[model samples]
Target: MMDENDVKELISSYKNIKDRVEIISNKFDRHNVKLVAVSKTKPTEMIRILYDKGHRHFGENYIQELVSKSEELSELNEIKWHFIGSIQSNKSKILTSVKNLYVVETVENKKILDKLAKSLLNNEENNNNNNNNNNKKLNIMIQVNTSGEESKSGCKPEECLDLVKHCLEDNNCKNSLNFLGLMTIGNPNATPDQPDFKCLVDCKNNISKQLNIPLDSIELSMGMSHDFEPAIEFGSTSVRVGSAIFGERDYSNKK
Candidate 1:
């Protein structure tokens, strides 16, 4: 576990990042963007420290690991859990059951959306009938394949509007799934001027306009450890940062 000093260093880093975000926000005159600390592989003790420091929003990229952490810290109500990985259908139930799950960042298909909608509705109904106590609308963000990465898990940009329409039209999904915004992972090597991120922001704007929705509430989730500052500058309501906060990641060391 990370000690107090280590936690302090992490908090300092977060403050620096937040200060940077504020500068970007002021430059653009938009203060609505949010910084979601990506705490995917960090230890629970580190997460507790972050929670204690008033960092309420955190993101995770794996189902099993997130569930394990949730169990270990089941009493924390102020934390918002965001599942930002490729969500499988089999794990939907457990993913939806986590308390205070603020958002899911990788819904690309209607099948998964249907499954999630049913889960949320059933959970709500069960809670209302006194069989359960958890009843909260699970927010969703449609993942868009802005970089055209073959290995990524998002719908192509052209298919996004139709999928959003489907999600809004489906009875089982409409009431349960709150279409919070759009998310994209830029090409790892791309710079701020790269067309990928710009294209995502454009798509987000067009969708919000065409759908006649409030632009402020429609999030544009993009950027990561590498290019999040520019992402915030270009109007990303939510940024999924991982390695920046947790330092470098060693994928080979994972089980």
Candidate 2:
């Protein structure tokens, strides 16, 4: 549904947002940190244009939206998709079924991990490619409830270690999932120094020391459309940026 002019506009928009994020990240020399453009409700036309402009990483919050986009845009070979949303138990299989899904940024407990692990294994089995685990592994991040907000879905800080250990102990999960590090959402109305973002950084440090995993090897996925700059300042290795790049979502005429 997009013309060439619309494609150029989207590319221009993506460059502007990415430049701003880079300006902030450069202050701390976070050259390798990623900007996962959250494109949940955005259409394939917009996403494809950005993909054409060399923005490889894109994120989505809902499984159906993600699957639809991936299916529609299957012609693009190098698009890296991120599931930057809350994973529903009933839709775990569908979420993992996305062909280009690069990271699952909402692993809060062993149950979701167990379900995804089973799904990943089954998928590999069905493909008759069980011998090669490298191609089937899914990257996952443990989300921490730093703010203790009742509305947020994540594991409490106190319970994070136990959950991480459980995920590591399950051979299938450990094999099927590449435990990246941690992720947390910030309150939009809050200031740049969001305590929740800091909590995620600290949690990752503690996990690295406790589990003997290299601190650099573990990444922190924090921040969003509103607070990504602060998240980068707080040692966030990756940010889930959405509206800032895609513009505001229109929730009209829906259930």
Candidate 3:
């Protein structure tokens, strides 16, 4: 249960985050962008308050935390869980099994794709037998390394088109994985028109044209606490902001 102080803080954080998103978004044509409250590392009590306050979308970076939280918050059927971290082959099945998993935003290569394919294939069979057509397919986003950062887990900008093509058309896994659009962690210091964000915009256009997919139908998932405003200006459909909404993370126990 949240104490008075905790409740106040959560309310303040949610309002600030919402206001910023609206203020920035009003300047753009596409103001329908989503605000993903990144609740990774934060406790469910805190997340619950935000959920109670009407923020249904939450993002998690780790598998264990996401699964456990989803189960814990099972009563709130409206919560949308987003897996925003690197995909591990070992954890693919667990990911596929997550209920209310609205989107996976970090698909980078063929190996992870193959593992996910197996899990999704199993899901298809199970759903087919059960006549559960509503949950047959899953939404997927290609994570492109627009910043060209070596440490980041994303496909290189040049490699993104083929990865997209593989997911959208050529791959056998398209039935289960609906390749929606693209995502990128733009360079923190770069301007909206610069390297990272620009690459994402350009890459999406090229790929959509190449695949004959309507460019407008593709969603761009970019921006975070420090850079969402510019990301909105650059056509980001959703911004993942954690610290700004959940306060600074408690990293004392983190490795």
TM-score of each: 0.93, 0.92, 0.94
Clashing pairs in 3: none
Give stretches of model 1 more than 4 Å off. 131-134, 250-255
Pairs that clash in candidate 2: none
Task: Output the better candidate (1/2) by TM-score.
Answer: 1
Model 2 global lDDT (CA atoms, 0 to 1): 0.83
Position 114, candidate 3: lDDT: 70
Compose the digit string of candidate 1's lDDT tens values, residues 13-43: 8887778777878888867677888887777
CA RMSD of all predictions: 1.8, 2.2, 1.8
Worst 10 residues of 2 by lDDT: 127-136
Residue pairs clashing in model 1 are: none
**RMSD to native, candidate 2:** 2.2
TM-score of 3: 0.94
What's model 3's lDDT at 255?
17
Instruction: Compose the digit string of candidate 2's lDDT tens values, residues 1-255.
Output: 877776766677778878878898899888688989888777887887787778889988778888888999988889999887788888989988898888898889889999999998888887776464545689888888888889999999988887788778889898888887888887767655677877877788788889998888988888787777888888888888777777888756211
- Which regions of candidate 3 fall more than 4 Å away from where they truly are? 127-134, 252-255
Winner on TM-score (1 vs 3) = 3
Q: Candidate 3 lDDT, tens digit per residue, 128-176?
A: 7998876567888989999887989899889988887777664557877
